[model samples]
Target: MMFNKLFSFFTVFLIGSSICFAQNANRLDSLVTVLENNKLPKNEKIQLLIKIAHNHTNTDEGMHYAKQSLQMAIEINDLVLQSQAWEEIGTIEQRLGNKNNALDAIFKALHIYDSLNLKDKQAASYMQIGGHHVGEKEYDPAIIYFQKAEKIYSEIEDDLYLAFVLTNLGEAYRFEGQLENATTSLTKALELNKSLKNDVVEGYALGNLGMVYAAESKFTKAKTFLTKAIAITNRLQGAYPTCVYIAALGSVYEKEGDFLLSESKYTEAFAMAKSAGLKEQIRDFSAVLTGFYEKHSDYKKALKFQKVYQQYQDSLVNRENIQKNEQLKADYEVSKRESEISILNITNANQKRWGIALISGFVILLFLAYLLYRGNREIKKSNQVLSDQKELISKREQEKALLLQELNHRVKNNLQMVSSLLNLQSRELTGHPAREAILSGKYRVEALSLVHRKLYQEGVDTKIPLKDYIQELVLGLFEGYNAEFEPNFSIADINIGIDVAIPLALIINEMVINSLKYAYDGIENPLLKIVIMQETKEDLHLQVIDNGIGFTKNDNEKNNSFGLKLITSLIEQLEGTMERINTKGTHWEMKIKLS
Candidate 1:
């Protein structure tokens, strides 16, 4: 159980059911003979060789056949066959404990898989690579590679392979101290394996979960899970998970202070590991046994198991050095082949030196002709694109203008309807003041409606020309009030935003109507001056002066009326200020800030 907590699991990606040819050597030999003599395509022959390679017991012999297959596949330019051969070589290297060589061979296959867009094959290769990283104690990189495999498997709907990857991923997470993630992945793997009826994988998942629980000090749950896992693995004849769970059960028992039960479990697991020929498990179980003996104060047994553990450790080191030497020889062979290729390239280059010079001169002439032709084509293409873009822009502008005209027409109609309603209501009223008020409202509505009518007639955009808008508004007001003389107009030639135009028109209507109604009631020459112009770089000014009766001393009482309040609110809304100059006549001046 301590092994699971501190060490990463070395997982094997089972691509398919393994051929039991190791126990049937005669059958394997027959296949190899058929491969050697058959008149098959180079690709098929290379595949047959790879099959024979997989059956070999000796790692070096397996690698030799794999290399032969690879060479034949390359000669035939069969990328899929080459990738298969490299994968076989990688498996053999991993079996021989040459991790770096194993990774190099696997990556070569992965490169081919990627170029061929073989998603399933790439996922399988990623799983194998991740397993090798886990064996090398690189948990972070191992988890990443395993996740890549998981994604592809899920996308391909390969649930069986996905479950296998999840089990391996859970072990990687456990070793990395991510217990929650480990539990979740392992639980999912367990459920998936159960659904697929893959008892072998299910056993491993359960055993791993048991170890994780033991690490978390959940002894009761750990014991129950390990017992079930050991029973399943033992029935299935899986020595791997059987030994792992047995040893983990021993640790749970030891943590619960049941020394006798712990010793029995460890001794049984050690025997199973020895019979399985699992050197790592053997080493782990022996170390656990040594600690178990020491915990019981049995010095003699502790010392004896300690010596056995050390021997296994030394054998592991010797095996590692042998793997390194094998890897170096492989690398040396690869380098020699590259050097031969380099020499062959140099010889070929020298033989073609004169031919290259002649070709180069012809290529230069051809390139110059191509450049001139391409330049002319590009210029024509650019001109066509410009013409098309200009036409498209013109069409869009026409559509926008039509839409604006429709909008203004609808608004003018709505305002006319409102004014008609007010006029009808005023005719029904008996009070003169009420009727007059309704007529004033009607005139104000007509003033706004005339502005919209002019805007649509001219087909302008969101800006209303101030001079045109004011002229139209004044003419409509004069017609509504039937003034004896038209109000003097002195407006500037400028454009204002649509938002400012509406409020400015309403203010003009109110001021002019007031002057017509009261300022010239009994006065002669009845001069009403309306002036609007830009006062400064940041201000626009409007003034209405009348040579008629000015505001009386009691004007404050009348200033609180609705019209005055409306004017005051509109000025505030425009963020402007107004002043009433009580000279010979009432002179109203307003300064509005330009945005």
Candidate 2:
């Protein structure tokens, strides 16, 4: 088992080769060169300097250099550089165990990048913030930041970065026992890697996929992918990320009841982490490896890893407490340095009086300055709140508009269905009278439908046009019927408002249906004419005449047919007077004054 976990120099070589192509520089020289280049694009130089600062170990000198770079970035008003600098500062602060400062700095950087729309920098900033949140076990916010970064990565079509972000997101999901989403995200990460041909990311994706599979007790497939990842890392010469790959693979081997293989891998990872100066990783690696050896009944090796884990844990606690003590001492020393002064007896009394007066003056000036500063801050906060609320209101309004459009869609569908049903009924009936009656009913529905349709077609926001309605009503009477059997339909001036046009259009449809069905059967040169005229601005007059059959008094009341009864009712709905004559063919006219 111990031998099975041994390092693959091939993996280490492969990983080392990939990073070797990156720009090389001495840390101090790189920082100085970037800082001295006053003409360089602000973002590029700052990013290069930050990369150098991040590679430095935790030390006062290293932190001082990192801070100097940040100050330069901020002084130039370079938002991109400012964001990158803060990220480096966060990395340094976190290494020094000032987690609060680290988190705050990274968050501030994230805010700056977000406002500037510097997406790649924003993603990096979010990833840093996520790292801190993960360290605190605040998984919810960690997941949020990771997802936001993933979205930006997707937008930029950076599949490699997207895969990495998804891996972390999957990790958070798995930690929360959301296995389904974890599997989905991790699987997508694998697909992305396949597209980019990035073997390193491919390995990571395989390892995470293995994690999900192992958790579900699919040992066989888990072993295959983890082993593939291990082999790939061997080709890379086992670079830093491979440390995580190995640690994860070891867990899969352990789950598969391969105790010896798991122990050997864990031991190799622990050694590599320490060699790489990843102390915290070594601690985490050893603790996990210890569990494997203990399960295998190797008490000595198990005890060794356990003892080392405890040693590291105790050392971290001691370091934190020591930092706290040092902070207190530093505070005391600063206070002491500030106040010590020398004076003689007579001079001391006068100095004390003068000091008191000076202090009072300074206090008043400070109070005034503080009030002005506070007032500005309050105003800024109020404006920000207002801006946020306005954005929320706009979002709600957009949602409301979408919902209203949907309603219009449904309404149009319903009315069209009603018209279709009436047409079908008209087609199935036999007698000329019955056919005319049903067809006429369908036309009335069509007219009503036209108004609803206009509402939909014009984006569901405008009123209907009376003149346009009459024109459509006249045209529809002749369409989709046999041309030889079609009527010579003509229109005159019409000024009917919506309320008048709606029912009046319905009546015309019925009268046209009647002429086409019975009056023009087996007859040549059939003509149906509709003329509408508004004698005054507030009044409309309409007439429908046909050179076909004439009407009787009984036909005027529709006493013999159901179709005529419906037409009479529709005419009443329009608040119009009706007249009919079949003499000299057929002549029909209606008049109405619309409000």
Candidate 3:
């Protein structure tokens, strides 16, 4: 009972039976006794209350006791009692025709189910609330509630409850004029009830199925399903009373134009109502009789039954006003709670703002401090990087200067030693070839000396231009030979870096010596030419020409000439390629790539 009061209510409701008034009152009274004194255990008492609210009396006195029990259950804060109470409230509201209050109570129960994470409770409450709305003739809301409940019931493996809810949903849909949807829902409920051996749910489904067929104007289907429903009701032996079953069948017979059969059914329904003492169904019997007499075109009898039906309908509507007020009271209690929550929220928001502001200020200060520290470190690191880069540039420059100096010194000294050796060899010989070798070595020394001379004269730290150095190298070689040469026979204007000058001068010495000594060996006229130019930004082109007998095949005959070997080695070291084209004389071409 307490559980019902605490959490139940979210949907519309009722588990109705065509029970006699006396039996219904007795059942409600017994529920009150068990729930009032807490005679049963917590769960048991809650279940009892749910049963009473679902299948109890249809009287106002029954509702009053249920509400009291529900309130008491709420005070105890028991979840089961809470759910039961909300369900009872919705049911009572539905009976009283106060649909909104019924809806409100069920929603409260749904909120509780959400808190408790009880899927079954949620589903059951939805179905109950849906049923309540249906009673108020609010079929749309009723279908929504029942469908939600059916879905939840399916989730928890409660086939019986799921079928029950679906059957209710089908009824709602039927009343809303959706015969197809109604038929589908009822059929599904029928299958589920059959599986669970729930003949009551099955019978409800069958009756609803017939109602849908009737609404759709499918008389054949309507008759078949109603006949089945009648059989189910008979087997249940008045457990759900006989009046509704007889009335449903009578209505079908009238639709089929079977006056005698229809009359028989209506009489039987009236008899059952009298025996059961169910005031509502007894009143519904008058409407059934009216439909029968109208089918037979008995205007007087039809009008009488119609009047009786009208009276019954009026009383039902009048009874609902009481239900409406009771629901408003329930809603008032819920509104009170919502107001308390809103007030608490406002107070909490005000309190939280200061804490949030303090935390935000602290965070901002921490971030700013971090940024400042990082900036200072970054500045210091940038300064260090600049200092290191400058030092590296300076060191490389100094090392380059020293390297050029050492290389220049070694070249000058090595050439002089070779010159001295050549001189000694020349002195030992009596021929001109020995003197030519001596002169050639001396010319190479002169070419290297020019680089040192420029470094000293120009006062630059490391490098010297090769133009002046090459001119000096050629002049020295000519002077040694004491041979005349025109400007056209010279490459004196060639330019190169000091790095390229020494090797180029050495190569030139060999070429010039070989030509002068051999090309003019027997001839009187001799010619030589050299030219230097750049083929690309990173490449240099060199050419040498001689007007004399061309190179012999013996020149390349391997493993012999020291001059040729030295020339080839220097070409490799410079990463330059050389090719020869012979005509009247040798034409040598080279293209060198510079780093």
RMSD of each: 30.9, 25.3, 43.9
Give candidate 1 regions above 4 Å deviation. Answer: 5-7, 16-105, 108-112, 318-595
lDDT of 3 at 412: 50
Error of 2 at 331 (Å): 21
Q: What is candidate 3's lDDT per residue for 283-376, written digit by digit as tens?
A: 6677667656655656567667766666555555432454454666576567648867999999999987776576676878768866886998
Best prediction by lDDT: 1
Model 2, TM vs. native? 0.43
Residue lDDT tens for model 2, 1-595: 2211221111100010112212234644666666787787755665556655654433455567667767878878877667666766776665544556676676667666656677777776676667666655567887898888888888998776777778778766765567799899888888887767776666666766666676677878877877787677556444345676677677767766787787777778787777755545666777776656655655567667866766664454433343444454365445444434433566788976786676576878768767887999999999999999999998687556555555655566566657655654565565657886566667777778886666555553545555566667656766735546444434444433456656666677777777776676555677777777667776567777777756656655665576667668877776667787546777877776566
The TM-scores of all predictions, comma-separated, are: 0.47, 0.43, 0.45
List the lowest-lDDT window of 10 residues for candidate 1.
14-23
Residue 15 deviation, candidate 2, in Å? 21
Residue-pair clashes per candidate: 0, 23, 37
Candidate 3's TM-score = 0.45
Residues 491-579, candidate 1: write the lDDT tens digits.
99987776678778888888888887888778878888889989886678999889888888786569888788888887876778999
